[model samples]
Target: MDLLVETFFNLAIMREALPLLLRGVLTTLALCAVVIPLGFAGGLVLAVLGTTRSRWKRFLLACWIDFFRAVPPLVLLIFVHSGLPFAGIELTAFAAVAVAFLLNNSAYYAEIVRAGIESIGRGQREAARSTGLTATQTLTWVVLPQAVRNVLPDLLSNTIEVVKLTSIASVVALPELLYAADMARSVTYNASPIVLAAGFYLLLLWPVVRLLSRLEHRIAG
Candidate 1:
């Protein structure tokens, strides 16, 4: 038991790694702040475009979304970080992460938003339009609000997945939480830093998980 504890839960190594890990937490948060908004905004635009009656437009949008969703985010990130340089488009690690995540996550968010939008009854839109509201105004005021509410659970769930996915940025040496923990582990020759990082992730995500559960139950009820 002592040996296991020392190997996996050494308090001294955890203490030593705490500051670096905290900085990593901040980086992860900042990455989320940047990418989440970008992804959501991009997704909103795509979802809105998807509402068009034009067959070609819808087909193109579907292609775009499917392409991004099909590509693994890590591979996309590596390409953005490493491959683009050959094309004379060099991006910093942070910027590359932002761009890659934006592309990958926007597809996911768009799908969720699109589903939410489709759930609204066509009668609501016709009613709103009959009231002299422009098509855009009707969508803005009537459809989107209810759509978002109906899919609130799914959006939050996707956001949680995005947060977890941010750990993959470590592969680019972005010094995110997992990367920092791995660095500390290498330096200290102890697994405690990794455990500490897991603790941080659990602390960060547990409340969201619980809240999502309550929400799902409420929605089901």
Candidate 2:
């Protein structure tokens, strides 16, 4: 532990890499900030479609979820960044990374939302319908509001996952936190710089996970 502290202050964090690493964190956070919400939106749409009674819609939605969930987001990132241009759908490096995360995170979020929706007792829906509420109205007023609350903890937890997943974007030449670490390591020929970068991510993420834990506990309680 002392060695870690010394390495942190004596080597990378003490050197000029602090600001560069901060820039990496900024980029990572920015990428997630955009993609996380997009993922939730996509996931919500997917969940709604998947829960529909139509077999065709459920099958199609399941196909989409399975495809995205099966493929690694890193592979998707590479395809978007390098492969898509061959077909004329060009995307910037940032756009590719963002789109990949948005799609991947959405798949996971859909499952979370679906679980929340399914947890609702069947009586609630029947009760709403018996009150003369339309299907859309019952879903909007009775189902979604309660389901969203039930799923808030899952959503917060997934935000942490989104933050971690941004590291994969580095392989596509996006200058996320891990990429900054690699750059610093290359220049310094030092492992400490890379450790510092990891520390930065942990430092940023730990508190978030802790807060999410509390939120989850509160919601569960």
Kindly list the per-residue Cα lDDT of model 2 for residues 39-80, writing each as its tens digit.
999998888777789999898888888889999888888988
RMSD of each: 0.7, 2.4
lDDT of each: 0.96, 0.84
Model 1, 1-221: lDDT tens per residue?
A: 99999999999999999999999999999999999999988888899999999999999999999999999999999999999999999999999999999999999999999999999999999999999999999999999999989999999999999999999999999999999999999999999999999999999899999999999999999
The window of 10 residues in a row where model 1 has the poorest summed lDDT is 36-45
RMSD of 1: 0.7
Q: How many backbone clashes does candidate 2 have?
A: 0
RMSD versus native structure for model 2: 2.4
94: Cα error in model 1, Å: 0.6
